[model samples]
Target: MKLTKRLHSCVQLEKDGRVLVIDPGAFSEPDAGLGADALLVTHEHPDHFDEGRLRAALDANPAAALWTLRSVAERLAPAYPGRVHTVGHGDAFTAAGFDVQVHGELHAVIHPDIPRITNVGYLVEGSLFHPGDALTVPGVPVETLMVPVHAPWNKVSEVIDYLREVGPRRAIDIHDVYLADIARPIYDTALGNLGRTDHGRLAAGEATEV
Candidate 1:
């Protein structure tokens, strides 16, 4: 499959003429979900779920479906009906021609004062894993891991450790719309120094084979 990193946590995956988009949020391009065969949303956070863009995509692609947590599903189901499906930890299903397994239950704690919200990572095709805002380790082997390099809930050390624990063949950056160009190399170098795995940040809109 080919993976293309959109703005922030948005990722587009394509294989055999089908397209699967994950987290086409407010931070992503307005048309990030365009032409998607399926959409996977991790949570209700604005950076990960943009209602406007999602509505537009679904309207444009009548055959496309949405898979997400209950909180999101509850709000969208009325409008889309059967097209919206709810998934939680350990649930597995097929969408856009690829098998997907859900992991993690809640978003990383941003602060004790802030109530935690639902978050679920996606393990696609048993090869690529996107953990959204959490540092969830999906016990099975991961070939290409999408790491949230920068987020209010995590630090540099946490990212490095997550990569080590997952031990994927490659680590790609996600949740990086806030990273400054000056600090991008520092994070890239830190990921590269973790060991034998290939690590790099994918430029927005660029596609790389995984």
Candidate 2:
């Protein structure tokens, strides 16, 4: 499969003429998830879920299906009916010709005063794992792992440890809207040295084989 990283946490995966998009949020291109065969959202955060873009994509692609947490499903399912599906931890299903297993339960704690929200990561095809905002480690072996490099809930040290624990064959940087160009190399180098894995940060709109 081919994976294309969009701005922030949005990622587009394509294989055998089918397209699956994850987290096409406000930071991403407005048409990020357009024409997708299936769309998976991790949470309700604006940076991870944009209602306007999602509505537009679903309207344009009648056959596309949306899989997300209950909080989000509660809002979209009423409008889209059969096209929207709610999934949670341990849930497994097939969408857009790819097998997906949902992992994680809540968003990383941002602060003691802020209530945590639901967040579910997707493990696609049993190989590629996207952990959304959480540092969830899938128990099974992973081929390609999407690591959240920069987020309010996490630090570079935590990222390095998460990568080491998951130990995927390859790791791709995600959730990096906050990172500056000057710090990009620092993160890449840290992951390499501490995590001891092949890691890369795909530029926005850049596609790479996974």
lDDT of 1 by residue, 4-105 (tens): 999999999999999999999999999999999999999999999999999999999999999999998988899998999999999999998999999999
Off by over 4 Å in 2: none
lDDT of 1 at 30: 97
TM-score of every candidate relative to the true structure: 0.98, 0.98
What is residue 83's positional error in candidate 2, in angstroms?
A: 0.4
- Tell me the lDDT of candidate 1: 0.93
Residues 1-210, candidate 2, lDDT per residue (tens digit)? 999999999999999999999999999999998989999999999999999989999999999999999888887998898999999999999998989999999889999999998889999999999998899987889999999999999999999999889999989999999999999889988998888789888989899988
**Whole-structure CA lDDT of model 2:** 0.93
Worst 10-residue stretch by lDDT in candidate 1? 188-197
TM-score of 2: 0.98
**Residue 128 displacement in candidate 1 (angstroms):** 0.3
